[model samples]
Target: MADSAPEVPAEERQEDPDVVDRKAEVLAEQIKKSKHFIVFTGAGISTSAGIPDFRGTEGVWTLMAQGRQRPSAVNTLQAVPTATHMALVELQNRGILKYLVSQNCDALHRKSGILPDRISELHGNNNREYYFRAVASYEKTVHDHRTGRKCVRCGGDLLDSIVNFGEYLPAEPLRLARNHAKKTDLCLVLGSSLTVPPASGIPETVGTRKAAKLVICNLQETPLDGLVDQRIYSKADELMTRVMAKLDIPIPQFILRRRLIVQMETTGGSRHQLKICGVDVDGTPMTFLRSIKLDQYCRRAACIEPFTISFRSDLDIGTELKLELEFMGNYGEPNLEIIYSYTGEAGTEMMYLLEYNPQTGEWKTERQESQSVDEDKKPTRRGR
Candidate 1:
C-alpha cells in the first residue's frame, strides 16, 4: 500500500481546524445580512499594540499568579498600544463598531481615543480613583495617626483610587454592556482566556443567544471555543487587519506621549505634613509616577496613608540627587538610581519625573541642602 500522508505541522494547520470553514462562511454571510454588530474584546486584541498579554506563557497575569513576577508590573492601557487598537478606533469612527465590551481594567478601549459615551469600561478605568467620597478623606481635623483629612462637603477619609480584590463590580457599566450584547447582531471576542467571572460569562451569553453571531479571535483557546460560530487563532493585530481590510476600514496613526505625576504626603511629628500630586492631564487622585520610600526617612506607621509623608527640613536638596521607585508584590526588589541635580532652598518643593525601576518595592530619594548663608528664605526641592 502507498505510504500514508505525512502529518501536518501545528503551525501549518488550518486557521479553525476544530470547525468547518463553511460555518464561518455562513456566519459572515449572516453578518452581512444583519444590522447591528457588537464586539466583546479581551486583552488579546491589545497585544498588537505592543501591549503584553496577561495570561499567555510569558504574560503578566500568569507570571504574577505563578510567583514568577508581580502584579504591579502590569502595564497601563496607555503604556502600550497595539495595531488592533488603532483599527478599532477607526471602526468606532466609521460607526461600524456599535459597542465594545472589554474585560481589562487597563482602559485600552478608552485609550484607543474612543469617546466615553461610546465605550463602556466594565472594569473601572485605572487612570482614575473611586471610593465612597464619604469615606475617602474623613479625618482631616483629627490629630490621630489614622486620621488624615475630612471632606469639605462631608467629613471622610480619602481612600486609594482602585478596585480591591473583594470589591463588587460597578453596576452601571455592566448594565450598559449587557444592553450592547443584546442589541448587537454580531459579536467579536478578542485575546482573552475567558476564564474570569462576569467577563467570562459575557461571551457565552452573546454566543448562546440567537441575537448575535459570535466570532472569537484569540492567540490561545478559550472556554467559549465550542460556542463560537467563528474562531480564529491569530494575533489581534493580524486578525484585525484582515477584518478591517475585508470591511474596507482604514487604520489611523498613533502618536505616543508619556506624562508622569508624583504625590508625596508627609505626616508625623509637629503637624508637619505634605501632599504632592501632579500629572500632565486631569485624572484621578491616586496617580503617581512611581512610589518608593526608605526605612531611614520613612516607615509604614509614620503616617496614616501608605503614600503619605511627614514634612522634614532635613530632606531638602541643593545638589542633584537620584531616586528609585519600586512597586508592591514579589517580583520587584530594591532599585537604585542617581539624581543629577536637586536644587532646593526652603526644602518644601519637589519636582517629579516619571520613571520605573523593575527591581524595587518603593521609591528612593536623596536630599541636598543649600550651602548659601542667605538662601534659607526660599524652599526649593525638585522631585523627579
Candidate 2:
C-alpha cells in the first residue's frame, strides 16, 4: 500500500507517553481550579468505540485531504460509548462537569448515561426519529407499516435527526450551549478538531469575562488552537483516565435493563398445536422472545430467540395460553468494550407480569418485586 493510503498504519500515529502525561497534569490542575467545567465534543472522542475519529491520520477528513476515499464506515446504530464517553459520565455524577455541547450525532453521550437536561446535541441524534409527538430528549419508536417507517400517530416518516453537512444546527441545543457558556469558568473540549460549523462556534460563546478558560484535548491541532487557554495533545480516554485518577475518582459502572416485547399471530399451524414468536424493543424480528417457561403439558426452549416451539394440546383457536415471560436484562461492560457499550446509572432490576384473558379479551399488568441478585440472569440481546 502507498504511504498516502488510509490504511498506512497503527504504529505511525501513536501518542507520545511523556507528552500525554505532561498534558494531563495541566488539565488536572485546571479541573481542580474550576468551579464549573463545561465540555464540548466532536467525533474524535468516539474513536475507541470502533468509530473513526474525523481528523486523525486515518480519519475521514485526513484521508479526504490526501485525495483518498473514506473507509467503509461502521454502522452508527451499533456504535457504543468509548472509555472517554463513560469518563464524562462520571464527571457529571461528581458535579465536576456542568454541561455538554456536542457536534457528533452518534448518540453515545445519551447512551453513555448523560441526561438531555445537562447536554445539548448541536447536531441531531441518529437514534432519534422525528414526529409531532416526539419529545426533546428521547423517543419511543413505534413501528408502522401503513406509512412505512412513519410515526405511528402522525403518519409521517420517522426522519433520522442528523443534520447534513450544510444544514443548520438545531436551535434549542445552540441556545442552551450559549446560555451555559456565558458563565462557564472552565470549558474542557474533548476530541473535537472544532472545524465543522455553527456548532463549532459554541465554545467561543464563553466570553473573556469570568476568566473562562478553554482546555482542549485533541490529537490534532484545531482551527481554534490559538484561542485556547491550554491544549492537551493526547487521546481523550488516556487523558481523561489520568485526570480522574489524579482527582481520586473512579469511572462509574453501567447497569442496563432493556425492554423487549413478544407477540404471537397464529397462521397455518394445526388447531391443537400453536406457534409463538418474539420481538425486541426496536421491533427488529417478527418474534424475539426473551424467555419462556411452560408447564408439563407444554415444552419451551429458554436458551434461544426466534425459535419455534411445538406442543400437542386439545384447545380451541381462541384458547388462553399460560406462559411465563422474562422482560429485562443487563448491558455494558466498560472494561471490555464489546457487546454492550454503555449502561445507565439508575441501575434497576424488575419484571412486570402481564396477563391477557382470551375469553374476556382484557389485558392486565401486575408488578413484580426486583429479583434477587443471585436470581438475576443475563438476557439475550438481538441488536448489535
> Which candidate comes out best when scored by TM-score?
2
- Top model number, lDDT: 2
| Candidate 2 local lDDT, 278-324, one digit each (tens) | 32233322222355655444565354544334544333433444555
In terms of lDDT, model 1 sits at 0.53
Task: Determine the C-alpha RMSD for candidate 2 after optimal superposition of all C-alphas.
Answer: 12.3
**What would the per-residue lDDT of candidate 1 be over residues 1-384, giving only the tens digit for each residue?**
001111221121236532434444454455456677777777667655455566666566555555565334435633545667777778778777777777666766655566556766665565543335234243553211232333222234433223434455567777888877777778888777777767667678888888678887776777788987777776666666665655556787553322322223234443334333333222322232245444544554222223344546544544333334442322233444434343333234444443333323344343333233322442221111
TM-score of each: 0.54, 0.63
Segments in model 2 whose C-alpha atoms lie over 4 Å from true places: 1-15, 64-67, 133-148, 152-156, 207-210, 257-384
Query: What lDDT would candidate 2 get against the real structure?
Result: 0.60
Q: Rate the local accuracy (lDDT) of all candidates.
A: 0.53, 0.60
